[model samples]
Target: MRSIWNGAVSFGLISIPIKLVNATENHSVAFRQIHIEDGSRIRHRKVCEVEDREVTTAEIGRAYEDADGTMIPITDEDLASLPIPTARTIEIVAFVPAYRIDPLQMDAAYYLAANGVPAAKPYTLLREALRRSHKVAVAKFALRGRERLGMLRVVDDVIVMHGLLWPDEIRAPDGVAPEAGVTVRSKELDLADVLMETLGEVDLADLHDDYREAVEELVAAKASGGEAPSAPVADRTGRKVIDLMSALENSVRQARVARGEAGSADVGADADADVKPLRRTAARKRSEAASEPPPSRKKPARKTAAKTTAAGGAAKKTATKTVAKKAASEAKKSAPRRRASA
Candidate 1:
């Protein structure tokens, strides 16, 4: 909580004494250069080219280098005597909407603390004013011998100042975007929307740096004389998609599966699984129709009637043949009896 700078915020006629402290810190792992062959620590010393000797910190000073390779030495007294109010004060230029500040212009952040009891009232007043107006105060302050633009806004009960780069410092994004001839289809956008929704809004606090954690683990393992843990490698098929429509369909299904939706299979596992839901539904309907028996038609009914008539005629002819055979057998028996009588 050490203050880097002690300055006063000039708000109209009100001067609020505040202490500037960095709002963020670097947690990344630091590495030192070493001699690989000797396993010894490597050191770099600040040496002057003209003298060809190492110099102490007190001997070093600031200078501006010109295009002609000439160094123009600048003294501390010269910088302090500069005719600018921002040299020792944060002078508010104007109050503007916070959205007017471009994110690309944002740099380091700091929290402004009221220096003493006398500054508390004015500090709180400015904080409340900024909160009520829903705007930020654009200010100019000198830090590290250079004046920088800053946007002042209220964070909770504290007044936070975010360092902003000058408009001229930002480069125009001319060739950063894709060429004009390329385009995106509505279908692709729909899939992208689904993917975004599937990922959803995440709490930033729940996230952490995986690489940093791994590095820490590796260092711990080395210190303990233990085997370093190996991270699992993902198995990628590296298959190039030939059909965008199918790819989008599979992506939607995969997203649904990831969101814990029921009856969703991992279509990414099967190369042939790239099927649209609408097309699948239509195919299912067609298969169901094919499986069911056909309906009774008028032509089928007429054919059945004709078949019944032919069956009746065949039965009558069979009956007539049977009666004629019986009459012939009786005549044969009578003739045999007459022969016996004679």
Candidate 2:
């Protein structure tokens, strides 16, 4: 990782030499605009409306419009003469409870690492102190020609500085009217809870970028002599929305059936197909044993011999036995298992 800024973090008379490294990285694929006809790259030009033509970089000037609608041009020297203070250091002003800050105020995060010289003692002290107090240090620093407000907190034994939004930047919840006189049935709420329970454990690793996968698949298909796929058609059925209570009940029923908690007619059909041959073969063996004289008690091995013959007669007998035993054990445990949905 490259350091975005290099400066010291100051508090009182103590200053720690540190460098700021960006904590987040984006893996998104990038593309540029091109001429569709000839597949030629496209470029943007800087044009001046006053001159009605493209202008060079050096010929451009910065100006601000005043209340009187007059454009006032400012030079680099004039901007430098302004009373704005430039402090490159991250100065901690005060410590506040971390929970008091809204998550939406957080803009960017950067890791602070000590430059060359060991900062182990001070770093550890600051990190442990913040962790114990559950507070974050509000700090100010200069970056990209402007002073910014930031929060300094310890995460995973390292100090990180996160940029914050100004108070005015946060939008107020005004005009967001609440639902009045709306009633919810108790049974509907209970059914919603049951549906949530049927969803088993969440594994973030299982989530993937389906769009990227689809793009790759399309590319492969095109390479294999297939035409490029068309864009997806939007769903415009215009069907009426179902009642919330009924929807919740149906969702609960579906979840239960998916988790094998409730057996459906389809499940019964599958179960019957799986056990039909086993039942028929077992009955036939029993009938044959009954036709023959009952094995004498002196030969107890006859029972074992009958069982072995019955097992061998079934197709994939060993595999079926193993699978049946495993299923039985899993059913006895009664814990929910997550399976990928088709």
Candidate 3:
């Protein structure tokens, strides 16, 4: 949560004092080099190629190679004093629609928080203004001794500043003509649109870094002297050669099923219908049995026999109920005329 930089955001005469906090964090597994045989730590050295000796930090200087193969050395102070001005202020030059900028131009993002109560007003104003206009402000500032171009946009009522890649830094795709054209049939386009319709809404929370998780697991296994885990096998069977019209129909059906507009039986009618209910019944029984307390193994046969005998006795009693009721009524009628035999 530490602020990477503290500066003011300037737009015309308004300036908002704010601190920049890094928006992202590295979650990759880190490792150190070690001797495989002895498990000894390995250290790197800074060696000078010409002298054939190790050099200290003080001996190192920045150098640029000239076109004539001459080495031009420069000190840190000289590089700092270069013609490029390192402005501490994020000076917004222009505002443009957010969608107009390509996502690839974004290098890094940071959170901009107002430093004090006096700065909060301008910060809020800029954020609300950006949201209302549906645009982001293109700005420039200096960080880590380099002049950086950035985009300021509102995210969840907070100003999010993103460092942008310079136009020169982004290379155009090579070996291809910019004016290349390809023809698409109407049927193919229609099918493509149907396929796109099957896709659900984008949910950012559903996305996860599977590769990073696998790498971390591998590292942990190796550290415990275990073999590396196997890579996941991909299923490549049942590849289809699509007929445009048929594919479009199938895609529409799938989309309807996904949205619960069509029943399961209506969607996959030809597939084994008996298998689904049977599987569901088996799963339900298994779940019920799993929830119940396990029967005691001790004297299990005796317990079963006792339960059976009790059920038989109850059945016999119900069968003789009419005779027993008639006998009881006769006894009551006779006993009313006699005195108690005290």
Per-candidate TM equals 0.77, 0.63, 0.63
lDDT of 3 at 103: 85
- For model 3, where is the 10-residue window of minimal lDDT? 271-280
Error of 2 at 255 (Å): 3.9
lDDT of 1 by residue, 1-342 (tens): 999999899999999999999999999999889999997999999999999999999999999999999999999999999999999899999999988999999999999999999999999999999999999999999999899999999988999999999999999999999988987655455556666666678799999999999999999999999999998886556555767766776666676777776363453356554465533344445555676889869888899999999999999999999999999999998997999999
Q: Between which residue pairs do clashes occur in model 3? A: none
Clashes of each: 0, 0, 0
lDDT of 2 by residue, 1-342 (tens): 789888778866777778899999866556689999998999899998888899999998888899998999987666656564335578888999988889989988999988765666666777788899899999888776567889999989899999998878999988687767877654445556556767777789989887777787777787798887777896635323356655555555556677787666634342112211112234445555565876678566888888888877775777889999999999866655433231
Task: Name the candidate that leads on TM-score.
Answer: 1
Worst 10 residues of 1 by lDDT: 276-285
User: Model 3: what TM-score?
Assistant: 0.63
lDDT of 3 by residue, 155-251 (tens): 8978999999888888887876656685655444544554575565778998999999999889889889999899878753543534545545555
Clashing pairs in 1: none
